[model samples]
Target: MDAQQWRIDVDREVCAGTGLCVGTAAGRLRLDAGRARPVREVVEPDQAVVDAAETCPMEAITVRSLTTGEVLAPEL
Candidate 1:
C-alpha cells in the first residue's frame, strides 16, 4: 500500500532556529545551520507536522496536502 505523501515548506529566512518544529516533529523536521527544514520531501507527515508548523515562533513552516494541495498550517 502507498501512503499519501504530505508536503511541507520552510523558509530559512523566516526561520529563527527556535527548534520548536524539530521538537514537535522529531523525525520529520530538523534544525540545520540554526534553521528549520523538513527532513525529507514529506514521505507522510503526521499531525505533529501541523503542530510543529503551528508552534513555529517565526511561522516559517507551511504544511500542505500533496494530493489535494490543501494548506494545513499558518491558517492560510
Candidate 2:
C-alpha cells in the first residue's frame, strides 16, 4: 500500500490569526491563542484549506504534499 502524504505550514511571523483557516478548514486547522495551528504536520486538506491558504491576507499559511514536497501555495 502507498503511504498517504500531506503537509501544512504557517508562518507565525506573518500570520494575522484571523481565524479564517480555522473557520474554513476546521478539521485541518484550529485557532490557538488567536493563531492558526495545523492539527498535524502532514494533513489531507480539502478545498476549504486551499481557500484559506489562498485568501490569507498575511500569506502565512502554506499547504503542500508531503511525499512530493510540492508547495501547493506560498505566501505572496
TM-score of 2: 0.81
TM-scores of the models, in the given order?
0.87, 0.81
Q: In candidate 2, where is summed lDDT lowest over 10 consecutive residues?
A: 1-10
- Model 2 misplaced stretches (Cα beyond 4 Å): 1-4, 74-76
Worst window of 10 by summed lDDT in candidate 1? 1-10
Question: Which digits, one per residue and each the tens of the lDDT, describe model 1 over residues 1-76?
Answer: 2346788999999998988888899899898999988899665758899898888888999888888878878786
- Report every candidate's CA lDDT: 0.85, 0.77
For residue 27, model 1's alpha carbon misses the true position, in angstroms, by 0.6
Clashes of 1: 0
How does residue 32 of candidate 1 score in lDDT? 90
Candidate number achieving the greatest lDDT relative to the actual structure: 1
